[model samples]
Target: MEALVLAWPGGEHAFRLPLAQLELLQGATGCGPEFLLNKLNLGQWAATEPFEIIRAGLMGGGMDAAGAKDVVSRAFDRHP
Candidate 1:
């Protein structure tokens, strides 16, 4: 399954999942990230954190999951 990651302003991140997950996520929120996360039982992660990291990645033009995680952690340390 191929996943396309989308990051938007105002702290929004979406994973364009493959057909199966897409079906599930779409049903929950019509192709929105919050809906997908809720449907996939990952709602606990909270959209703000991932979205902030994603926003950073998108702005920098370097999107890597591990790198995003690292950036998120550092951001968390500074802000939290």
Candidate 2:
């Protein structure tokens, strides 16, 4: 798959990233989806809008596997 791209302020440089990298990019580089979107003043994508859309966005199909278990456990580790 193609690596995703992330840019720095002023477009000075960009990094090619993966979806999995999102798990820790905010802490490591001080630039993740939330910060970048808000910094750019494009908060619409920072989180789902129109409240009603959020539920469908967060819902997912079942995955009965060890990795799936880890994922479910981690969701509880996070706060709403």
Candidate 3:
């Protein structure tokens, strides 16, 4: 599958959500991926949604666990 490249505070990173990651995301958010997508589209997403999505996507895109968490932390600190 194609990856979505996103620019974080540190640098650009490729993000993807395979089935496994999506399942994890759903569990984390207590909602399905479709509902999350809808919330994002309508600009009504909770703060944790973007964080969870980005972290999961980064992992799915082959980033190491530490690296993904660091990137998300720095990015959200600046942008949030």
Candidate 4:
């Protein structure tokens, strides 16, 4: 599966990823704040709080409205 990596507006890192990539990362280091942040960018969420992002991820795992929101939120927060 193709993976997308998007970084917060100014963040050095990138977010956005495919399920396969997510799974790979999970196997490696588990879900850390950084990983969540990256996913948030991919989803295009609009919040910064970890819980909010987590919820977004859960709701948007399928890459629906919720997931987009989470990704945007992460990007917005990271944007500097």
Q: Which is the leading candidate under TM-score?
A: 3
Candidate 2 lDDT (Cα, 0 to 1): 0.34
**Superposed model 1: Cα runs more than 4 Å off:** 1-31, 34-61
lDDT of 1 by residue, 1-80 (tens): 33445533334444444444334334434446555456447655544544443434333444455655565566566766
TM-scores, one per candidate: 0.31, 0.24, 0.87, 0.24
Rank all candidate structures by their TM-score, best first, as comma-separated numbers: 3, 1, 2, 4
With a 3 Å backbone cut-off (N, CA, C), the pairs that clash in candidate 2 are none
Report model 1's TM-score to 2 decimal places.
Answer: 0.31
Pairs clashing within candidate 3: none
For residue 69, give model 3's deviation from the true position in Å. Answer: 1.5
Whole-model Cα lDDT of every candidate shown, in order: 0.46, 0.34, 0.90, 0.47
lDDT of 2 by residue, 1-80 (tens): 44223232222222333344343344434566566547557544433121211111122122233433344345434633
- Give stretches of model 3 more than 4 Å off: none
Model 1, residue 30: what's the lDDT?
A: 44
Greater TM-score among 1 and 3 belongs to 3
Candidate 3 all-Cα RMSD = 1.4
Better of 1 and 2 by lDDT: 1
Per-residue C-alpha lDDT of model 3 across residues 1-80, encoded as one tens digit per residue:
99988876777889999998999899989979999999999999998999999999999988987888888998889988
